[model samples]
Target chain A: MAAGKPVVMVTLVSSDGQSFQLLEEAALLSAMVRDTIQIGQGRGPAGIPIRNITGQTLSMVVVYCNKHYTAAAAADGDDAADEEKKVANKKQLREWDEQFINLEQDKLYDILVAANNLGIDGLVDLCCWRFADMMKGKSASEIRVKLGIRDDFTSEQRAQIEKDSPWVWSRTT
Target chain B: MLQPARENEGVWRLSVWCFGVDAGVQFSRCENPIFPLIPSMAQDGGESRDWAEMPSDALSGVFGKLNASDILTGAGLVCRVWRQLATNDPTLWRRVDMSCQADLVENMKAKYAMARIAVNRAAGTMEAFSAEYFVTDDLLLYISTRASSLKSLHLIYCPYISIKGIAEAMKGFTQLEELTLYLSSFHGYVSEAIGRAGQQLICFRLNNAFGYYNCPVDDTEAFWIANNMPELRELQLIGNRLSNDGLIAILDHCLRLESLDVSRCYNVQMDDVLKSKCARIRDLMLPRDQDVFIDSDPSDEGYSYDTDAMYDSEY
Candidate 1:
């Protein structure tokens, strides 16, 4: 609708009662918000209220959508038909993605939760990869320390678990 | 407009490449209405998100990316929740590799019991299962029943596993492709079953050539393989005692065989006639023709004598 018409801005109300404005197309990048927009048929004057997201997280999600849409449009162009150029474009997008996700631990998780709430498949996967990478070579205790979680199991229960599956006990690597 | 858009562009652009294509999709969202979404100031004594608080499915996704041992031993015993999830999650147990510890004879019962838990979690989705020790008839019976979709099976040092048990198990694994039975004593019952059912087998490694008692694999085993596994594309038989006759039979019978490793099998000579006869095989590794000799260090013997005479020279 924005091809010749003036750019329409959709107001997004985050959980903390703050409002952020975004281009309609950029807001539609999130599957949940896109559905809300489609349901409103561009007529919801009150704006869509994201009940679980904060102002900062919503802003980040908007920025992600706008950037990804641009990359996706570029990658879908005619030159992308060539396998090598398409791969290069994907690699470029991935490198940009790497930089985007390089936030602090809690911030990354926050973005992950926000992405999931917004129904952003791409962002969810990125956060999951970072999450997995953090746990890859780390011991359970190390993962606990890094992620700021406490060891909830008692020594008795831990010993029992070790008894049940002693394989984990013997593995040093 | 362009400069601002470029900067904003960096804020977005997350893709599946960050994680693997399959994993890190989503955890069932647990929205704690009281847990404020805003990051609290450091002075407010604020609580941040806990790592262990991710959804069970999302946590399973992380465990799914880890190796089996890492999942079972490293992640499984972390805490009650992780232990339960690791024990119960099917995705983490699909490809069980017990080729290392946990397969020792002493821990055979416990580990095999643990293996049952894994295969049970895996349901029918199990693809590859391998163990370096004691794959008894009982384990095969349990696995064959559970992991019906199994494709690759490697059981090394399972001298206790009867050929009949494995052969019976092989009947269910019609999708079987890669099979490795290493460091085991001789048996021929598997040949009949493999020939009948394992038509899809692409790689076969029978390192029965290794011996606890140095009893090498003879022409009997070779002839059984020649008669049975004609569909094999790759084969390895280290420490085999197969003679020229068995090799000749194999080359003639297994016409589709592309890669063969008969290393340490001194009896089968790769003469010109034999080489030309088996010219179609691309990645063939035959036993070396001559024993590779290293030059003896004659000077080293004189050095010891020179050291002994040092006391005389000092006097």
Candidate 2:
């Protein structure tokens, strides 16, 4: 509620007792966060209890929001120094995003679940696209084992599937 | 037990021996460690095999992410379940581009019809349709009826499409945004029909086919487009008969114009007409042979023609 501070702020509490505070402008990037802020009075400090997200995931989300918020603020300023600094900041943020999403399979799956539950569109898209990219050049069986999927086919059904797509079985790599 | 010893006893003994040989005999019994583990290994192998097949929904999700070529060659024909899942995903058929194969128009039509049916059943609507060749007027009408949600239509090398067909098709598509027509033989009538359709067209591309048979500079289609389509942002006229007047009209009308390509247009002097008329034009494509001259003489008509000067300055 201070004069220089953001008009709205959201307090996100992860399952591990860690809290992430974000400015309204940054939170508005997510429709869910914007709607939540709209429902509550924009004046008071509010805490959003996120049951699904963990400390690690919540930290990553906050980092993304903070970077975007600073970039947006710098873009709004008319000063040449601010504009030049913001362009350099944006390039650095892009590199950070590329590195931030390079997580292991198990961590990636957890992040995907957290992002989906938190209604983070950008994060969800990044995770899904990464998963889809991993699926390339992999056979059906390899994909099943890698993704931890159970085979629900009968012996007759398995034979039929193999008969329908012999390429899936005959692929070398 | 001892029996009476006689010549008949020997014969009876031999008969008993023959009977014993005919019956099954038993050897020494022993245990092998490797044989005991075979059953368990086979059972483990079966368990791993069972873990290979994935759930149907997950398979569908993976298939939905594949591109069109992969969907056709790999996912659609994988299995009954995969085929069902791949066919069910609507995003797979959002944009159907058959512009690359003009020679196999009939085959492409058949494939498109089948794709339309599948997409309709799965997604409930087909949003866009693009084709290289327009063989019959009826085909265009049919496409218009089937793809009701169609927004973008690209036609290339298809001269058979008349103004009437375009008018009929444009009537249904109120949300049409981008239209790219290449080698179209339609003239002023088609441009008029497009203007009447009342849809906000953003991009219009017309190639050599829109020009006159010999003297392309005589074609007035460019003027018609400049006067009518006010929402035009990008315009490309290749091998057309666009003059300085037509270029001026376009520059005056399309205020939001970003990119313009007017290659092989002999009539319009680039530096004299374009640069003076539209100052905001960023991306411009001009023919290589023509030299832009900048004429400063007030008495002569070429004085206003600063084509050569502007060309030299830019280079």
RMSD of 1: 11.3
What does the lDDT come to for candidate 1? 0.67
TM-score of each: 0.61, 0.55
lDDT of 2 at B102: 33
Worst 10 residues of 2 chain B by lDDT: B23-32
Tell me the tens digit of each residue's lDDT in model 1 across A83-133: 988888889889988998876555677788777778788888888787666
| lDDT for A57 (candidate 1) | 63
Superposed model 1: Cα runs more than 4 Å off: A1-12, A17-29, A41-47, A154-159, A167-173, B1-46, B97-114, B123-125, B130-142, B154-165, B171-196, B199-315
User: Can you write out model 2's per-residue Cα lDDT over B123-203, one digit (the tens) per residue?
Assistant: 536666667774446666666666667677788777677777787877766667777778776644456677644337787
Please give the lDDT score at residue B227 for candidate 2. Answer: 75
lDDT of 1 by residue, B196-243 (tens): 655677888877543211223358767877887778899887657677
TM-score of chain B of each: 0.69, 0.65
- Which pairs in model 1 have colliding backbones? A64-B12, A168-B73
Model 1, position B33: C-alpha lDDT score: 30
